[model samples]
Target: MQIIVRAYEQSCAGVLVDEVTVEADVSKTGQQSTFSVALNTPDEDGDGYVAILGNGKGGTDCNDNKNQRGALMSPGNLEVCDTIDNNCNQQIDEGLDKKWYLDEDGDGVPRGPDFISRCSKPEGNYMEYPDGQQFDCRDTGADAAKMFPGNSEVCDGIDNDCNAVVDDGFPTLGETCNAECGGVRVCAADGLSVVCSQEPGRYYHPDRDGDGQGASGSLPTLKCGTEPADPGTVSNDDDCDDADPATCEGLAEVCDAIDNNCDGVVDNATPACGGTLKNVASHYVNLGGDDWKTVSVAANGSVWVAGHDGKLALRRPGAQKFESFSHYNSAPQAPTDGSPVLNNNNCGDHDWNVSWVNANGVVFLGGQTGWIGIHTGAANFTCVPGQMPTSQDAITGMIGFETGGVTTIYVGDTSGRLTRWRPSAPFAEQFTVVNNSDFAYYGLHALSPDFVLAVGNSVTGSVQKFVSYDIDSQNPVTPPTEHVANPNNISGNVRSVWMGSATSACAVGDNAAVWRWDGGTGWSKVVGPTGVTGRFSGVVMRNDTQTQLIGQCYIVGGDGTSRAKVHRLTPYGWAKPLDIQSATANVALNDLAITPTGEIWIAGEDGRVFHYPEP
Candidate 1:
């Protein structure tokens, strides 16, 4: 209830103090307390609007006293972008504001992420934001034509539209370009500024055999994705065989004498005795008359041939004729030094049964009566004093290597003696006989300085023996053990042994008895080709640092009269004997050597030296 007082006639207590008092009871009312008062007035700002809110009187202005503020800046005014709630909607320029983006290039497509939502666009380097999030990938430039969406991209080092790829839209963008190496055009490494340049390429290794398995730990061939039509290649490099399809990764491993599992070990499941036999074609050079006992390949591509009656010949690589030297008997020595006369002087007249060539191409010819002849270049031989510790004996087999300028030689004599001879030792101690018995070492090879493999005959028992000596090693010395199968069952001497590595070797001997060293003390028989029986005096394998080799193993021997036989080990047993030339019919191939240059050198009777290169 409201009360009004008119002070026209009877006034209240002091005329200027017009006041009233009101009261109400609230003992048990539902509400705790409720009281409010509003002074209703009209035209407070003189705009003809009341100041009371919901007093049943007309009031529309939130700020009734609009005179203190702007005259027309009220609920009845228009809203503008001045950063203030001018129209009193509890918002500053709500419907009148716009979001501006950094469009420095003025390309219409602005930067997507960075923007300013305000009443107006920024002062500089900005524009009204586009419909969607548009990125000015390169926002610094002012090329509206080229730096906008749907524009042709050039090699101007910028991403006009943020297509995620910095270098796209080029017609030949991924063409293979050859610079320092072959590579295709990919995104720049930084993935920032676009350019004609690209990062490095993926690598693909070679698959020369078209087996889809490349050489293990292989080298990259042509750059990836840019290979030729027939450019056989493999992604994972894992192959130890060349043409054998049964070898490589994911292939079944068997006892095929190859690393079928590509684990770098030759058939670890079982000891292999044969391999993929190689077919070879041989060419021979006849030195004539004296029987050539040994042939060696020198490091400088020269071939040294030593033989009976103290004969030695040097055939430079690719030379058709031999420069022969003589000692005991008068062998033809054509002087290349223009000495006007041939060299007919006696240089140690006896049979030179073995020869070894050092790294410097110096050939040491071990001869009968404990003699050794050293030949350097010319048609002259420097005879060393007798090297035997006892009576005169012919040096049967010899192998040597040099270390720290000191040459260490191992000599095998016909009298079943094996000695280590150093050129620097005293005469009495020069030939330190390592083994002296009735066990003749026909061939001795050193897999390392500490590992020596010897194949020979046990003269006392007349049986075959394969011995390995781990000299001065953690393992004790292994004495020679005779392998006596039967009176005629591979019981002949193991004449020659060639080590493929410290763990693998091949040996052959009389009676066509072929054997494979089990990388240990045991020897397994590689039964000879059926219906063919003869002697295998020499054996050689392609040198490989790894135990799993992919090349060939050759075993040679013959009858003393006709038909020199050359056999190769096969995955089954033995390949048929290589067809021998008619000229080499009477020449029984005694020994063969494969030089580091991949040349096969074979020597035999009547001063014959053959160079056999397999196809």
Candidate 2:
């Protein structure tokens, strides 16, 4: 360890100004101390003044007893040593020899006889004369009496004791004064009691609250009603129910409108109708008792049911019963059993697939005879001016489009041929084959306008493919582009495809197979519940975040039946399908639609048209 000391003031001759290194060597017998010195200045020759630099002592030989006292000399006065009592008064080097003053009783004054000697041994102990005489010094106890008389002993130049002089020196013994004046003092022999002069206008707490009454004297006294009372023990008599402090005066009483406490209000004062799952109405429409095959909702919220009997019956929203229209009757008729033909001159003797264009309230039905039927909030149906392909290859799917004042219909036949029908042109000019390829049985279900997605057993193998045509192209008779293709082994005959948002779409197929499309990320398979296997019949995108796939399954019964199931697409993944109750265990869902308010409309086999409100 290295220690360094710096001095601010210069010392007299023989004072050292050097750096020294002290080292200690320890051995078995003892430790030897050695110091290496470096001197900064030299001593003058023949001047009796030697430089003490590099020397621990002030140039005094350590072996000389005469020079031992020189080691105690003050740095400034090199000639005088503070170790001897030069001006003796029985104490060695007293007075200024110590840095501090002697305050025997801590009276802020030097209890002196001003002896010129060294400080007392053991430090902090003071030497005093027997007579209690003191050296009068500035700011010391000597000056305290001369500057302030009859005042309390403050460090300021004022003696508050009033002993006919300021700070008449501190008392020799601990004493108590009757007043601030240094008179009528009571001395304690053991030097314990001490009472200084009382401050002016401030008494010794004669009475409580300092009212100066009740045993009012120099001593302190307690007054009545001054001390705080025990809690809850007050004489005010203002609180009636002291136990419950809040139920005091000025509290109002609350009524019985769900307000338990009398706070003048009710609990949950306002109520709102929270959106919750209400009742779901599922009904099956029987078409002329012909074992109702399918149900669908038209654009104008009219419920239509078609079955093997070839009768098309309709029911509007909130209607109690269904109504049937004659082949081309201008007026709607009551529910009948006859094979009601559509307004379009097409014979009504076949199972039909139906889709609605809500914008114009048009109902497009395709089955044995493909036709475009119109119902503008009226009971009558008018046919558009074009005839479909032929009865041999019935229209399996039809999509209507009216963009930029050009109305056209895209029809997909069972032979996987997509045809465009423009009503205003001649028969030969109106029907044009868009895509007539080897894609077999492609039209079980179609998506929309320009996109005709088909899934069935192809000549090559069981394949799922989508053909998209640009309707605005000048050559509208050209083949569509095949954008998606799934190997038959992986995707076994996709039966239903539902597109939502432009990005989220789902295709379901046989064996509980489901595939999801997320725009740029093509398609990925989705896992289904274990042991549940069947093909999906209808798929509808309810919203951007939810999709519903309906199909038949053998999960519940050993035998296969048309079972309706709904699945919701969440952030994590697609949820398991929840079964929707159907009138019959084997009711096959054919089509699904979601109203503007998110109500789910399902058209299924056996005229099962069910309406499920959004959950």
In order, the Cα lDDT scores of the candidates are 0.60, 0.44
Candidate 2 per-residue lDDT over residues 1-615, each given as its tens digit: 554442211444334445455444554456546565554433333222333434353342211133444323322333323555332233444544443445443344444444434445334534443344333343345544443222354323244443444333545333444343333333333323433433222222312111112111224322232343333233333322222212223443221111222233332222321111121222224432333333445445666554443445555565644554324223334334432323433334454554445444445555544543433435444433234653246465566666676657766666666677665577667667776756644333334455444444454766665544545445766655554543335645555565554556666666666666655435666675455566655566544212212211111111134265544433333333444544343555555655544445555554455454312
lDDT of 1 by residue, 210-294 (tens): 6687756667654434434335666657766534444677766664344566676654654233222122221222435667778
lDDT of 2 at 528: 58
Give me the runs in candidate 1 sitting further than 4 Å from their true place.
1-288, 331-346, 379-381, 473-489, 544-551, 560-562, 570-572, 613-615
TM-score for each candidate, following the candidate numbering: 0.49, 0.45
Q: Which runs in model 2 stand beyond 4 Å of their true positions?
A: 1-284, 287-299, 317-320, 326-347, 369-387, 390-392, 424-428, 441-457, 484-488, 544-562, 569-571, 576-586, 613-615
In candidate 2, position 218 carries an lDDT of 26
- Where is model 1 poorest over a 10-residue stretch in terms of lDDT? 8-17
